[model samples]
Structure formats: C-alpha cells, structure tokens
Target: MRSTPPPPQLQVVAVVGPTAAGKSDLGVELARRLGGEVVNADSMQLYRGMDIGTAKLAEDERGGVPHHLLDVWDVRETASVAEYQRAARVEIDRLLAAGRLPVLVGGSGLYVRAAVDRMEFPGTDPEVRAALEEELARGGSGPLHERLAAADPAAAAAILPSNGRRIVRALEVIAITGKPFTAQLPGSDEEQSVYRTLQIGVDVARPELDARITTRVDRMWEAGLPDEVRRLEQAGLREGRTASRALGYQQLLAAFSGAYDEETAREETVRTTRRFARRQDTWFRRDGRVHWLSGAAADRAQLPERAWELVRDALGR
Candidate 1:
C-alpha cells in the first residue's frame, strides 16, 4: 500500500497520454497520493455502456477513488464540448470547495483544454449553421473540405476530410465570424487556466505503445466487447450521432453489416487505434505545460515517484 501522505495544496493534476500508455492506472495512483478525485476528460468515455471499447476502468480497478463526468450521456446523444466543459468545471469546483484535489484524466486534448484553459465558444448562427449543414448533407465533405482548405488551410489540415461534423462547424464559424476558426483558438501557452494545474503525461516508445494497444484490444475481445456492443445496439447505438462512430464500435458495426468479418474488424480496430494514438501523442507533445514521464516497463515502478516530483516542483516543495 502507498504510505506517503497526501500533499497539502494538491489542487489539480492532469494525467494525459495516448491510448494504452498506462494513463488510467497512473492517474489512480496520483489521485491516491494527492487525496484527489478523478474527473474524466475522455470524449468517448462520456457515453454510457462504452466500457470495454473505451477501456474504461471498472469500479474495482479505480482503487476506490471517486470519479466524475463519466457515463453521463446516453448512446444516442450527440457530444457537445461546451456542455462537457460546463459539467467538468462544476465537479472540479465542487471538489476544490470540498478540499479534495481534482485529477483531470484522459487523452482528449481539446476536452482537457476546455476544462482547464480559458477557452470560449463562439455563438452559433442558426441560418449559417443550417445552410452549412445542408451543404454537407448534399455534396459530402470533399467539396466543403476544399472550400475550407481555401479559406482556412490550417483548420482543414488539422481536421480530417471525412469528419463532416467538424468540417461543417468550421465552415459555420467562418461564415458567422468572418474569420478563420484557428485564429480564434488559443495557442499552446497563450491562454491562462481556470485553476492551477500540474499536467503529467505518460508515454512509451512507439513500438512499446503499439504492442500495448494490440494486447489491450485482444483482451477486450476476450472480455466480450462484442457482447457489450450488442447490448448497446439494442439501446440504439446504431442511431447514435456520436457513440456509433467510436473506434472499436465503428469497426464492429461494419462487420455486423457484412462489410467484413469480426476478425478483420478487430484487426482494423487495432490499426486505426494505433493511428489515433499517434495523433493523440502529437497533440500532447505540442503542449509546453505537460511534464512527460515514460510508461515503459522499466520506468513503471518509478512513474508515481516521477509524477510526485513534478507535483512537488509545481508546488515548489
């Protein structure tokens, strides 16, 4: 058992990294040492009944820490970052007021930033949004992406062409604000956070992380991810605006539609997840505030201590 007492001024700690990089376990350990509770920042983990695919820690795996902002959305609901920001801040504030540290955990870069950084969402214009959404529905994302590329090449480069939702929103912002979406976004270091934060990033080498992801996907299959998906399907997962499009679930649904076999779907899930992890790594690496610690097996024993050192440094201990 960990015997070191909790720190006096443990305010906020963000455990961030790519999938299968050991962020969750490390966050639990950090929360234990900091007298903290966890508030999730994973966008996918917000959906109910998404446990196995999201690698959401079961109750027994959390090491008794109280967690918030998970399983708050039904499968059919569309995800909203603004709504998530509000909900997460409420819990963080409650935890602070109650004298418990707030451990913000996950690899969703934008969601994490929305919770901690002073980011403001611009107002939406209904006419502009409706027109843009109608265009997206008609011509697919390719034409719209070309337009975005012409208008704001940076945002187009950042967002995927197949991501019609974000592309539409980006165009909507351009039409409404008459400015590039990225122009209004905060730089890595320009914005101030709502609370004092010590963000610790857990990472391993590419090969090591790839191996971990493969092993995790294998384990999820063995743990009946198909069964979980089936249950969610009964609960309208296919109709979900966001949940149906998640990593593993999307691949599995393709299999269900006879697009591929389950084995092929699983294999593709591993490959797609590896690519997603690379993107996640790039996102966290761009941030200057995070104190990164290796999650290699050799370093696993010292991860908690290394994170504690960062916390102490942040506290000027």
Candidate 2:
C-alpha cells in the first residue's frame, strides 16, 4: 500500500491587543486548553532583563507551558522585526512538527504581522541609512520627522517624534523607494498569510485600559522597576538603541540621568503608555481578520473560557 500524506499543520492562533489587556494570562490559559506552546510576539519582551516593565510572565505563572522567544536578545542589540519573524517562524514550525499548537501572543501589532502574514521588509541602503543617522545625530529627529509628516502623514502619525531610529528608517525607505514609507505595507492586494492563522484580539474600553495601565505602571514601580533599570543600565542598556527606548526603561533612564525627577518620569511613562495603547488599538482595528473578544476588567474571571470558546468556534470544534 502507498504511504499516506501527512496531516496538515493546525492553524496558528494569535492573541493580540493593547497593553494591560491581560493577553499574557489568556495566552497561557489557551495554551493549556489547546495543548499548545506560547510564542512571544512582544518586541520589548524579547530582550533579557526586561521582565518587570514588560510584564513578562514568570515561570510559575506560565503553568508549565513552554514559551519560545523570550529573552532572546541582549539589551545592547537593536531589535529587528525581520529577525524576529524568522526566529518566531522557526519556533512555530517546531511546535507544529511536534503535533502541538502554537499560541502567538503579544501587543506588538507589527511584530505579530511580521510573524504570520506575508510581510516583506524592503532592503536598506547602508549609505542612505548612514546618512540619515548622521542627520539625526546632528539635527535631532525634529526636521526629519517634519519631512516624514509631509511625505507620509500616516507613518509619521504612527511613529513618535522621539523615536529617532524609526524616523531614520522611514526617511531611508522614502529615499530608496521614492514613495511614502507606509505605502510599502501589505495592502489589500497582499493579504496572503504564510500560516493558517486564527487571530484573536482582546478588547477593553478606553477608560478601563487607561486605568489598568496606571495600575500596572504603579505596580512596576513597586516591583522594583527602578532597580531593574539600574541593573540593565549597568548591562549597557543606554547604549542599546532599541532597548533603551522601551516604555518604562526610557523614562526611568531619563530620571537616572537627571533629565527629570523620578515622579515626573513615572507620570510620563503612564501618559506615553496610554498613548501607545491607543495606537495599538488603532493598528489592530485596521486588520479585518481579527476576531475580537471582550476583555473588560470586571469580566476577568470569564476571559479564559470565553477565549477558548472563540478558538473552538473558529476551528469548528
């Protein structure tokens, strides 16, 4: 008798949403129920020694489920979504080959897209990139950001003025392609995904999310975020272009450097984080493939079961 063809790999399930929406716990619960492992998609969580501010789950909190891609990069190394995409796909493929589901989880929308979607990053010209970096160093991000705003208002709106690295990248892309940077993103014509994916978005009201963010930031401070930053700063965090700019770390570093007081840094962190959450919501809302599930704070107890129901429904199980 002829050998039979192997079974198709199961669809990759992704849990995504704004920060403070309880995605980590829900991902762990889903992995437990679905016989799956977790693949982290949060860009910040990929760095070592970034646990407290990123709200990374501890081992006990993971409930024995295997998690891949956490703490994969040093604080001194810049994070590349393309590199993350490749690494994440390797882990996902490994889990699938082992007959286990892969539950991809995080609030970083672009990283999630890079992992599962047919996303392609444009090649960078080193000369152009170097020139942009030099320009950024000499004049700061203000002039370049204004140019970006004129060239691609949407991209500029999405990127913060303080993010010098991204500002340079956008300008470089604009120069290389002779088109707006955002124009290269996957449009309706390029929606094909590499894996069979079931995307679940955790939804929370703005007020509740803002409140949660405040509480979480306060908890981070109580949990020794300052000390954590101090440790990482000794580990060369300030020299790490990407790692140094992480939400809480950036503000705390400013405080450590005497640019601001600790209280002001803490308050700015909360304010910027709330703004980031709004941007995350806007980004995910644009993707029509997401199946949104209510994740209100009051409904916390029911989230896991509700998430499981959504998964089962998606799979027609």
Candidate 3:
C-alpha cells in the first residue's frame, strides 16, 4: 500500500532558537528550496541600518529568495508585538495568496507568538498610554512595577525590572481595561495548529554558542560598528525607547558616551549577548513545539541541509 500523505494547509515553518545559531542561514536555504518567502520574526532585525549587529541577510546573502520585514522600521521608531502581528498578518496573507510557504525565522519568541497566536491586545486607550508615559517619565519603572504588582501580580512577576517598556505597558493596559495582561492574551493552545506550523529549534553546546557570540561581536567590530553607531547617533536615533536599548546599540552608545573604549564596548557586547542568548534559550526551551538540533551535531558544512531534511520529514514531505 502507498504511504499516507500529510494534510495540506498553509505551511508556516518557524526557525526559533538562541542567537548565533544560524537561524537566518537555515531559514534562507529552506525558503530557497521550498519555494517559500522568509518573514523576519526578530524584533531588532526589523530596524533599518542595524545590519551587522542584527546579522541581517545581505542582498547577495538571500540568494535571490524574497524576504520580508527586515529594515521595515527606522531605528528611532518602536516596533511593538501588536505592530509586528499586524505586519506579519499582511505578509502571511500575501504569501499564502501567492501559493508560497511562509518561513518565520528568528529568536524573538514573543514575535513568533504574536504571529502564530491570536492576541487580544487589539486596541489601545490613548489616555492610558499617555498617562503611563507621563508617569514613566516622572518616576521611572519603580513606581510602574509597583502599580503593576498591585493590579496584576502575575504580569508583574513575569516581567523583569530591566524590561521597563513592557512592564509599563502591562500596567497601562490593566489600568485602562481592568484585566490582567496575561488574561488579555489569547489562548496559547489556539496557536498550536493554526497554520500547519513546523517549529525547528537550533541549539549548540553552551560553550560553542558562547564562542560564536564572541566571534560575531568581533566580526561586527571589523564591519565598522563604531561608524554605524556614530551615524545613528548623528541622526538622533541614540535614545528614545526600547529599540535604542537593544544589545549592540546600547553597547555602542556606551562607547560613544565614553563609558568604554571601542575594545571594551565590543567585549561588553559579546558578554551581554551571551547572557541574552541564555535567556533566549530558556524562553524557547519552554516551547515544546521546537525540534531541537545542535550546530556540531553534524559537520557544520552539511548541517543546514540536514536540518532542512529533518524539517521536511517532520512536515511529512
């Protein structure tokens, strides 16, 4: 008897994992072979002129495969999950209408969640947002976190002190809507099978990932990261909101402000990037959807093709 065939639906292949795991490269190749379009699901990579640090795929790097969402926003502008969801929905519809598979690639678990899940953060109260912004400007995150803790302790506990923007937004939502932020979010189970998603998680030994981070930071330095930051600073993109606080941008800002020399800033970038990678790993590990693969699990040269094969088989191709 012939083997049974898998069900056909809109295919959404998500490549999610820690940073420095070659997600973009794998996703690009997968799209090239599968006749799909790549949609960036990373928050930082969406910003224009953030090429090196965000590890954006160069024009030639895309190998003529169409990609979406890279350089979609100015670095000075904030890109929220809701905004990403909106843009991603449009792209998903376009790709599906074109009869091409959609490949969502990045380490931003939140962005991926926003794309696949139906979220309830649909409307925002301008009054509440303005009030929160005013309060944050005056007293900073301490009072905001306190307010969030009082109203929605779960959200308070889930968000970090360093994540001031999200914490403030959570409180602002609760203040205006009288609902827990988590409760406002749509059902997690709702996203599980919405789009025939195939989740691939790329992993590597911790030490190896750390080495990759170091090497990537060194490469960014060689690629004129200092000059890039100088240009952004000159363009008044230095400080405003969360986008300015991204890993390399913040470090380079520190260097620009004389907080550290170029060498020191680069080292700080690598160190903090590794920590960020660890946090990403922790977050993605909670996602049971991912099929984990190691970089050195096979030869580096053949690994991406092997990963594609695994994804193909997982999709029952």
Candidate 4:
C-alpha cells in the first residue's frame, strides 16, 4: 500500500487580534507543530527598540522558530502597506520553497490583509506624496478629510477624521491615480495566492479587551516605557510622523511634558489602545474569511490544539 500524500500548499495562516491577545505564543506553537515560519505583520513591531510598547516577541520567546520582518526598520522610517505586501510575498514564497508553512501574525489589520489578500495598493509618486504631505503639514487633517469627503464620500464615511495618515494617503491616491480609493480595494483574486490561507482572529468582549489594554498599559510604564520614549526623543526621532503618533509614544509625550501625569498617561494609553483595538476589530470584521476565537478561553494549552485543528481541517492536512 502507498503512503498518503500531504495536502497542497496553502497561501498562509494569519493569526490576528488586538494587543495582549496572545497571538505570538499561538503563532509560535502553531509553527512548531506544522513546520512553519512566523512572519511579522504588525506595523509597530517592525520598528527596532519598540519591544515592550509593541508587545514584540523576544528572540528567546520565539521558541527557536525563524521569524521574519520584525524589528527590521528604523522607527523613524515609515513603511506603507504596499511595501509590506512586497516584502511579505518574498518571505512567504521562500518559506514555501523550504517546504514550511508561513504563519503571518499581528494585530495590524491592514498589514495582515496586504499579506493574506495580496492587495495591490497603487504605486506612490513622490511628487504626489509630497504635495499631500505639504498640505497636511500646513493645513492639518481636517482640510484633507474634507477633501476626501468631497471626492469619495463612501471612503470618508468609513475613515475617521482623526486618521490623518490614511486620509492623506487616500487623497494622494486620488491625485496620483485619478481613481477612488474604495474602487481600488482588492477583490477576490483566486490566481495570485500561493496557498489556501486560514485567517484566525482572536477576540474578546469589548469590555474585557479594554480592561486588558488598561492593565497592559500600566505594565508598560512599569517596564520603563517612558525611558524608551525619551531615548527616541533624544535621538531626534520624535516629531509629527507615523511612529511618534503611535498610541504608546503619544501618551508618553503627554506625561513627559506635564500635560498629563504618569498615571494619567497610562490611563490615556489604555483608552487609545482600546480605541485602536476597536478600529482593528472593525477593519477585520468585514472579512468573513476570518475564524474568530474567543479570548475568554485564551489559554496556552488549548489555543494551539484548537488552531491546529482549524488549520488542518481548512487545509485537509
């Protein structure tokens, strides 16, 4: 009798959730079980020395599994979704060629979608980006939001006014490509995906996740997060840019300037993190492909077993 052949290669397994949801541990164990490599998908985790704030998995904590794309960029330099897609595709392909599964893990919904769905965000023109950046720097996000609202009301309705980065990027797309941002969203692309992907989402009740966010923020401060931010500030990396505007850094700035006390800063961090998590949930909920696993039973022992079952069932492995 002949032995059974293994299932065909799937696109990738994407483990996504809000902060403090144990995505990294799950990904590590899943990779160990399935002979997979972990790929970073979080926006903040790519920045060097942003460990505690971004909740990056330490090298030792990775359980000797090869992880890609984490801590590969300077915090001062920003990376776009298109860039992430390109890098992730190369990494994923390499993993497959090595006969290992690629496990993409992070809470950054846009980055995860870019890797899994393989979105084709329009190429950026420096002149167009410069123009939009100038307008945003001079006027602010309000004016840019107004412009986006006028041009693409649907996208404006979906995007928050406070998301200055996205608003400006959308306007840049319209200016550069002469096409609406909503229309450019990647639809079903059956041909491009290398493997049949299993998208796993870890979720908790809003209140519970918010509480976890609060606790985690307090813990970050206790772990010398302010010192980390001060180092970045002294390095001249703090300014009106993408990384500085991250929830952890923004709250710390307030504390450093006496606008808010340390405790208040921690509280604000929790609030902002909760809001960011909510936005992440909203962004990911639209994709019906994700299989949501509750954080209520988020245990080290159970998640791996369950996730393996889900992946095996999905891939017929």
User: Whose lDDT is greatest here?
Assistant: 2
Show pairs that collide, candidate 1: none
* lDDT of candidate model 2 versus the reference: 0.91
Model 4 is weakest, by summed lDDT over 10 consecutive residues, at 186-195
Candidate 2 wrongly placed segments (more than 4 Å): 1-10, 188-191
**How good is model 2 by TM-score?**
0.95
lDDT per residue, candidate 1, 92-137, as tens digits?
9999889888999998888999998888887788999888889888
**Residue pairs with clashing backbones, model 3:** none
Cα error, residue 98 of model 2, in Å, equals 0.7
Model 2 Cα lDDT, one tens digit per residue, 1-317: 99998555447999999999989999999999999999999999999999999999999999999999999999999999889999999999999888899999999988998888887788889999999999999999999999899999999998888889999999898999898888767652224688878888999999999999999999999999999999999999999999999999999999988999999999999999999999999989988888898899788888888888878876777
**2 or 3, which is superior by TM-score?**
2
> What local lDDT score does residue 191 receive in model 2, on the 0 to 100 scale?
49
Clashes of 4: 4
Clashing pairs in model 2? none
Q: What digit string (tens of lDDT, one per residue) describes model 4 on residues 81-100?
A: 88888899899989888888
Off by over 4 Å in 4: 1-9, 188-194, 298-301
Candidate 3: tens digits of C-alpha lDDT, residues 81-194 = 888988998998789878888999999978887887666574677887888889887988888888788888767765665567888788777776777886775454534445
Residue 156's lDDT in candidate 1 = 86
Once model 1 is optimally superposed onto the true structure by TM-score, how far is the C-alpha of residue 234 displaced, in angstroms?
A: 1.3
- For candidate 3, which ten residues in a row score worst on lDDT? 185-194
